[model samples]
Target: MSKAHLPTPPDFLIKEFASFQPKDRQAIAIKVAKLERKVFPAIEHFNYDVELKKKNIGMVLAFKEDDTDTVVAYLVYQRMKRLVWLHKLCVLEQEREKGLGKRLIEFLRTQMEKGGCQIHLWVDSNRKPAMALYKSCGFQQIEYRPDYYGPGRAALKMELSIGE
Candidate 1:
């Protein structure tokens, strides 16, 4: 990705959910899990209980500045040295087109740049809006895998190099 600046949406406050108290984090996890099921296909849905316990995994959630308890969007990623794998990015259906997705990507990029990490992800080819969002954040297409999702669905592998 280019070094161009990416602006965060001012209405939403995004932060790593790990910093919260165990009880609060558990509450957010339940909401996130429910949101994931509503937004993502079953094939792509993750088990937040198991995923949240990983040391390498990180979850960034976006909440309305006025309402810290409700999650409006989220981005999940795994970092290992200079490589970061972006696992999932989702915004509640009612919250789409408000730049939440790009904001989350920019947030991750800015944080990972300190360590010169390269972010990688495979987006389902059928999701045009998602592809556009990532591309807008300067993610370059690296490869295309046919039938990666199923018999007809495909996947596009993309990457964004941060300060590398």
Candidate 2:
């Protein structure tokens, strides 16, 4: 990835992460978990409550200011030293092609770039839309793992190194 040029999507419905109160925290987690379950198959489901409780993991959710209950998209990541591992990136089926997923990724990059030097994630090779989205954001495939998701579901390890 070129440090000199980072792709920025048009300002879309991105509500950058915010400090959530205790109640808000649980509410958001449950909401996001629900969204994940609806969008991803059971095999790919995550325990949002447990993951968000850890210190290094964080998530960014996008929703309309007027209707926060309807979560349009979310990005979950785990930070380790200078590297951030993207756990999941999901946007509602009704919300695709609107640049929400890219914005969520860009939002995460902007939030982590100061302390984090790179972002890495394993994407299911069968998921073409996801592959395209990450590639559009300058992530390059670093490795390929066959059956990482299950037999016949290959996974691609991709990375984007931030400016040094």
Candidate 3:
């Protein structure tokens, strides 16, 4: 499909990826696995314990209309102290560059404001596109590590103080 064919998320659509459920075990696992493959390919396996904890945490999943709804994007986060740590943000290949990421981040900031936390996330150093997107959204890189993502993959810790 052409770039213009990318779907715009609906204004009436809700912004939340209700945490995975035991009954949804298979579906959630498949979705999460696909996400990890495309986004965290270097990681051999996901941390199940941490993922289980994420079930109780807040999240957002953006869906676009099709014959049946399809998840176009998603965000996973948790609060630590006064910081809102975004653990994951994924937008399908077809959905990228359509401004869905911007809307998702803005929604996260609003969620942080209501919860009284500042938003932050750990980004891979080489992900220039993600860094640019975060920068455009007012996120500043506050820290960096030479090999934070294991082996040669480095990381940039970014923060966005909300409701200030």
lDDT of each candidate versus the true structure: 0.88, 0.81, 0.68
Please estimate how well model 2 matches the true structure, expressed as its whole-model Cα lDDT: 0.81
TM-score of each predicted structure versus truth: 0.92, 0.88, 0.76
Best by lDDT: 1
Q: State residue 25's C-alpha deviation in candidate 3, in Å.
A: 8.0
lDDT of 3: 0.68
Candidate 3 per-residue lDDT over residues 3-28, each given as its tens digit: 21223456323345443355764465
Error of 2 at 122 (Å): 0.4
Q: Model 3: number of clashes?
A: 1
The lDDT, on a scale of 0 to 1, for candidate 1 is 0.88
On TM-score, the leading prediction is 1
CA error at residue 133 for candidate 3, angstroms: 0.8
In candidate 1, what residue range of length 10 has the lowest lDDT sum?
Answer: 1-10
How would the candidate models be sorted by TM-score, starting from the highest? 1, 2, 3
TM-score of 1: 0.92
Q: Candidate 1 lDDT, tens digit per residue, 1-164?
A: 33222345877777777767887887899999998988888988898889998999998888888998889999999999999999999999899999999888888888787858799999999999999999999999999999999988999999999977
